[model samples]
Target: MRRMYFIFLMLCSGLALAQPRIQLSPPQAVVDSVFFTETTTVRLELDYPGVALRYTLDGSPVGSNSSVYKGPLALSQSATVSAKAFHPDFEDSPQVSIAVRSLKYNQPLSITNATPKPAPQYTGAGLSALTDRQKGALNFAATPKAWLGWETDTLRMQLNAPEAGKVNMLVFSLLDNAGAWIMPPAVVKVYDAGEQIGQFETARPEPGGPTQYHFLEVPLKPWSSDTLEVLVLARQLPDWHDGAGRPAWIFLDEILLTQKP
Candidate 1:
């Protein structure tokens, strides 16, 4: 009986090693690198006509009971996405794995000095609109939007602290609509108790791969303060880009705060 078991195991290993490997449509997809906002709907595609695709989101191995790839996966939280191709003639394609992180943040209690022209359409109760856990995606603007628009080059806002604590980072989410001429802020400066604490700059458009939505995370040394002020200044569009000379509209949302653990 022992000899038979050993012989069976050796045959199975040999058969597994002979299977053909499967590939994904987008080569950029990899493990632990891709990040998506919670509102993002990611579509996975492969060109293998005869091969069926099976996927799992809870770190489980794909089986006959697993989900079949039919449409885009909506990521509402962090998850490990794994998938593979199957065909009767070919061995199971090597599984592709990736970690998709859902973006969620805790924002400031109140914001002052926004003065966003076309005031935030949905300001609930007070100035806590930006951080109200509401968010907007690429389209379907107006309602259920977490964005505030300031048709200017500069925006200054004061933040009220949740409690006395040490903070080291500030994250701002902005929109870049090339058609609408909405651009990103180039400089971010932080002030604590009326004195400038730190300032950071972001790189402009890359040679390629400029994103429609941009997130700016500025790091600051650990500082204790009850209130912090932020200034966002944007550079005007060059003659080459569209909507030049007019005020560079800046849309902002999610003033996330990060503190050292």
Candidate 2:
């Protein structure tokens, strides 16, 4: 009986000496994704203290061999990012990876739209605005210089492609501040001259989300055209919503044209 009690005490002591499980925070969508038009700055966070986190951007194994995270990581192109948390006595946390992507369009763009509003000095943009590589944040006015406003319900634009190739994606980055009565469009259409190429639709936000930002991208028919025309029709607000009769505002920045030729 004495020997059995001694062995049980040893097991209990060993269990008590073992280190606790470490929990690391993963990148959340709104906070990390969709915040930029050209480049995205990602920061790492953890749920527990005293953990040393290491990360890699090149899809390599993450460990002490990887770069120790000291500050926010900036990514300009697509990468498979991996991270792991390390502690002295505890087993290393499982590797966490996320595929990060952004539009890499720096092509000079020529734009022609019907009845386009003059971009305001501080908060608006013109035809050349989309390719300017500027980005907006959570606030409707955070990156105002990058945004161009249109008052009409319908918008028509003709864009000249920089390279002749297949465009895989078209990113429509937009802002939603319903209280200010600025909302996303009901439907958007892309045309290569007269033929329809791609179409995108948006999901309405549950009421009471003020100043929300969303990236709405759609797959193209893998279009190959020198010039593309885009049409956007805003959703008509109901009587309960303010700014009726008044034209819905379409705030646009970086109409990202992602192509691989």
Number of the top candidate by TM-score? 2
**Model 1 lDDT vs. the true structure?**
0.62
Model 1 regions more than 4 Å off:
1-108, 116-126, 140-144, 206-211
Per-prediction count of colliding residue pairs? 0, 0
What value does the lDDT take at residue 28 in candidate 1?
22
User: Number of clashing pairs, model 2?
Assistant: 0
How do the residues 1-261 of candidate 1 rate in per-residue lDDT, one tens digit apiece?
Answer: 999999999999999987755433421223322344445554556676676778888657776568887777776765667777777665666565554444454334556545444345533234465655454454427444556667667777888766545456776766777566667777889888777776878666432232355556677655567777888887576556665556566777566675523
Q: Write the per-residue lDDT of candidate 2 for residues 1-261, one digit (tens) a residue.
A: 999999999999999878566445442222366434467776766655677888888668886878888877778776666778877756687676554456554344556554555436433555676666566654656666677777677888777875645456676767677787778887888887688888988765455554654456755675567888888888776556665555557777766667532
What TM-score do all the candidates reach, one by one?
Answer: 0.57, 0.59
Model 1 pairs whose backbones collide: none
Query: In the order shown, what is each candidate's alpha-carbon RMSD?
Result: 13.0, 9.2
